[model samples]
Each structure stands twice: as C-alpha cells, then as structure tokens.
Target: MKGIAFDALVDLFPGLGGWHYVPVPTEVRDAIGGHTTRGLIPVRAAIGTTAWDTSLQPMGDGSHFIALKAAVRRAEGITVGDRVTVTVSRR
Candidate 1:
C-alpha cells in the first residue's frame, strides 16, 4: 500500500507510563489494515526530518498508535501536545 500522511497531536498515555504517541487516525488505521488484535505492524515512519522504523501498537479501543521514541522526539524538537506531521508506510 502507498504511504499515508497526516497531522496529529502528540499525546502522553498515563497507562503507558507517560509514553508519548500519535494516535493513528481511524481512516488511516483502516487503510493500513490495522485492528485491535492484529498485534504490531512493522512500519517505517517519519516526523519532520527524523525517520525511523517502528511498529504501530494496537490499542484496546480498536485503534492504533505510534509510540514516539524519546530520541526521535528530541531529534524533531517535538513534545507532548505538539502537533506533528507524520508519514507512515508498511515496511
């Protein structure tokens, strides 16, 4: 499938011990064939000029989120509550 791009707000999940993430929009999740039971989907993602390989974590709410590693966030100068443009594609 082709790459998907969108803007989303960075958020911290308390349950995940304050880990930051970008919620993958429902439409994008569907486009990527993501489901709650699908386990992690390997992907290549980019934010600003920082690019990395990570997996999209399926959430219990039938959604998925991309965990933002601290290094990636620091490289992009991003923080929780910031709006970031994300580009993702299955690897």
Candidate 2:
C-alpha cells in the first residue's frame, strides 16, 4: 500500500461545542476512494508519532475531514492553523 501523508491546518467548528478538526486532503480521499459508509470512513490516523483509530467525517460542502480531539492536539502540541503532517491508512 502507498503511504499517505500531508500537511493541513487545525480548523474549528463554531457552535458545535468547540469541535476541532484537520481537513483531509484530496489525495488521501482519492487514495481511499469509495471507502466511506454513512458519511464516515474508518482509518488509522497518525499525527507525527501518535497513532489512533478514528473516522473521517463529511462536511456539508461535499468534502470530508478528520476530527482532532483536544487530547490529540495536546499530545501533538499543535493548535489551529499549525501545519500538521497527518497520515492515514484503511482500518
């Protein structure tokens, strides 16, 4: 399998109780084509060296992204707009 990694900024979703995320790039989406189920895609996501099992969720604009919970951010020492190298693989 091909390695998937890319830089993205941490984004915030207002009015959703402080939900934060990192938008998955198109390349990642294309690499895992048609793997979504009910708007969520299961994957093993990693930030730097911390790996976790998470789901990529769809946004209203026909795009998909991954949620970066506070724990992950804190563990990775990253904040919004901070470029992060995210890697994902099929779960």
Over the stretch 1-91, how does candidate 1's per-residue lDDT look in tens digits?
Answer: 2389989999998875788999988787667666445588888899978889998888777778999999999899998899999988878
**Against the true structure, whose lDDT is highest?**
1
Compared with the true structure, model 2 gives a TM-score of 0.86
TM-score of structure candidate 1? 0.87
Clashing pairs in model 1? none
Leading candidate by TM-score: 1
Alpha carbon RMSD to native, model 2: 2.4
- The total of clashing pairs for model 1 equals 0
Off by over 4 Å in 2: 35-38
Worst 10 residues of 2 by lDDT: 29-38
For all candidates, what are the clash counts? 0, 0
lDDT of 2 by residue, 6-88 (tens): 88888888885777898887668778763443478788888977888898888867678899977888898988778888988
